[model samples]
Target: MALGLFWATVSLVVFLLISTADMLGYLKPKNHFDVDGKTVVVTGGSQGMGRALGKLLAQRGANVVIVARDRQKLEAALKYISAAAKDVEKQRFHYISADVTKSEENIRIVEEVTSWNNGNSPDVVWANAGGAYSELFIDTPVELMRSQMDLNYFAAAYLAHATLRSWLRPASTKQTSEAAAAVAPRHFIITSSVVCFVGLAGYSPYAPAKSALRSLADSLRSEVRLYNGYRRANPSKGPAADVEIHCVTPGTIFSPGLDNENKTKPAVTHILEESDPRQTEDEAATAAIKGLERGGYLITTQWLGSLLRAGMLGGVPRNAVFMDTMKAWLTPVIWLFMQPDLEGKVLRWGEKNEVKLPQ
Candidate 1:
């Protein structure tokens, strides 16, 4: 007992020291870019989380541009965002109708927005255009699967690529020096679902696409770091062009999309999703924006979502809070014991219902 107590005391002290060191390292000045007067673009901005995000950004005094395929919806979203804007004259709101799933349309959309802004690259580009459908893998049509990937993955990729290319153009070619000055501290946000990490029944098509975003975000983060390094080495270019890439993994959000999803979502899928607290679109957007402002690379909008993220311990970047890391490391261990029971429930449901599996 005495030996065990001695070791426990030593362990506690060591843990405290490590936690303190990590906290200190993480406390360094974070660059939370100001959105005031910055041009911001959001895809699928006509409705749901996209509209919510647009409203919030406009409220922050950003010049908001909302993109969607539906002209009427785009006009409505513009009005919604304009109403929320801080200064009507300065924080302008505009909408463009474009099919984001098409690569060419994404390019044209960026060009159009730049032209409208007098060749100024947007300071922030949010790829919030995505859709989810839940069905048994066999029941999911090939075309539906393809469309989901196109909308959820390709759309975001095209937008990010186009925006980044525009943002990285030579400073001398910018319409004005002020435009070049606005280029650094750029942000690209992707709205990835919690299903990205925590896959469930009837979500095979949707989960993989969202999971692909994790890889995309990780790769971009590394590339951005390298680009920033080069800029830092070349002092003549002024400050380093810091492009921050963030992937927001929100759990169930109550939006128009969710309403549609609920109509077709399988019972098992709903059961699994309902395990986590559902958030309103506004709440999710608020959490996501706050996470981005705090320099979070992987953002979660709810406690359960955060726990699942931490528990997975994927290669994604974390917030680096000591207790959060500890919870993340420990949660998986706890889940290891809990998951079997959860799996058993799923299996029992499948067996009792004789649910068909895809060959």
Candidate 2:
């Protein structure tokens, strides 16, 4: 009897393992582009991850347009990117200081970048400037949520629309109509967070905004593909094959802002500071280049692959991840009754678990 019980348990475990591997394989990311010498624009290009991506792309010979509201920071980032490239004469980089939240400003930035590219629109656009604060729902002001929406969702959408509009427009009258009709390669990239998939506890204002962004990206991907297909079927009337959209979800980065967030909190400060295995800005920059070159649809940190794999299998929409987190947090009693052994199993599974951030 004892032998039978042990073998039964082993069989069950083996079955579960096989099922898990199949799911992970299905969810493995597909790589899509090599961005070398491409005309690319990175919003919030002055600091943090945006600056990191810009510098990395420039190093790989991409013509980088660094966009930010602060001119000084833009100039500083340009110097850093140019220096990273090292061969000053070979490097091609530009800067446009503008606030992306406003439609007019977004249009202006697009125009400025296009002008520098000899009236050719940028081939790649990285909308990486959005973020939100973590505060208790009751204590959080309404404006905070509004601000998050404007910065994270609206700005990214506006930039994409403006870029597509400019791309579809003719370049110049000087060139023959046929010569001017040639289309340039294009990509729209946005920096979304893991919070787009799952919400934890304190991200009330930010998580929903990110969730909206995920939906936008998914919808935009379909729209771009459909539009392109329609044009391909009718070459004379359709859009050129040079336009695409990519959404990137990077896991918790050990950024200066994360450092600052940790420092301000009294009890968790030491642990937060110590927890980080800091990657140099240059290293992060390099990673961005690799991800872009591979044409990654949803770029994530090395640490996030498992959770994302699990997420894909559940057939969970991006927003469903956030909702599940809330349910888990609010119904601990329900969880205990439903999966009495899950806690021990979760703990034993791994030490560095991919925890969901509070929404």
Candidate 3:
């Protein structure tokens, strides 16, 4: 009798979850990314996915600022992006040659962008300036780990810190609370990797940094609500607008960064990632943009990404709660069988080879 009752309760819960998710999914916005007439800042915008995003946003009618440390590539990106502008007269494009790894430089980026935007903060900021180094943890140098952390995690954190401080401030007395209420929400997007969810054999140095980015997004997503709640309480005296934090975990891409990582990627490491879906720069950016438009907090570009993310969803915000819950339920069962296969490969690789420690 107890077993039957427990089964009955489980069925009821599943029913309710599905019904709710269906209703919510149907109500989701079609194009919530809404960049038209907004000023956007994209780091790593000189090439690859960043440049594709900049160009796409331009086509959708955004005034874009692309930031990178390379003047030549940025300048080239500016022209490419500028030509794609939906409104030649109204939409503008510029490039900033600044290394985002420096905190002070990030602060200056915000200041310069604010100045360029006629004394207003950018409506969106995309942190895509990061790099990767692959090696067994034992073979990896402590110094390389520091560089990985700086490029992948701290760089994005520095920019985000500067952005939120400039954004989350006391509203100007000149602007009425009702006007602020009508303002659209702002977006902060960070780019992580699929490996962040599941650590691999050869990515000891890179995966943790990307994982940090995911963790930061999750924490900030919840914390930003405090200001938004204050806005709700004191509509006339709160923040300028609602803030949404999103993390985009893109799968492997055919890009220059990937090219660099491949030169050092271990053979067994490549075997571990053989199943990952591959997307071109434009494809990844386009899919990610669509996910953001649909109000996804943790966005993934492909099927494998979604599956990987489902297995690891802790307390993060949900894109489709019921679907995610169902996948989350099934992923562990799948992992039960898959984990051994992966472990066996790692074991065999270790038996056949040894990593030469960097002196």
- Which number leads on TM-score? 3
TM-scores of all candidate predictions against the true structure: 0.88, 0.71, 0.91
Query: What alpha-carbon RMSD in Å does predicted model 3 have with respect to the real structure?
Result: 3.0
Tens-digit lDDT track for model 2 on 114-191? Answer: 888887777888888876566545556688778878988889989988987876543333343354245444788877
True-vs-predicted CA distance for residue 143, candidate 1, Å: 0.9
Compared with the true structure, model 2 gives a TM-score of: 0.71
lDDT tens string, model 3, 1-359?
Answer: 99999999999897776767675665555777899999999999998889999999999999999999989999998999999999999997888889899999999999999999999899999999987898778877799999999999999999999999988887666356667667899898999989888978989999999999999999899899999898877876777888899999998988998899998888999988887689999999998998888889899998889988999988776787777887898899989988999999888987898846557
Off by over 4 Å in 3: 1-30, 173-177, 354-359
Clashes of 1: 0
Q: Cα miss at 174, model 1 (Å)?
A: 10
Counting clashing residue pairs in each candidate, in order, gives 0, 10, 1
Give the better candidate number (1 or 3) by TM-score. 3
Q: Which candidate is the best by lDDT?
A: 3
**Model 2: residue 238 alpha-carbon error in angstroms:** 3.2
Residue-level lDDT tens digits of model 1 in 1-359: 99999999998888778788765765454648578888999998999999999999988889999998899888988998899989987777788999999989999988998888887777789999998988878888999999999999999999988887876554443233444345558898899988876768879979899999877988998887776565555434533256788889998889989888777787877666566698999999999988887778888999877878888656666676665778787887878876786677678778788676667
- What is the C-alpha local distance difference test score of each model? 0.82, 0.66, 0.89
* lDDT of model 2 at position 165: 84
Residue-pair clash count for candidate 3: 1
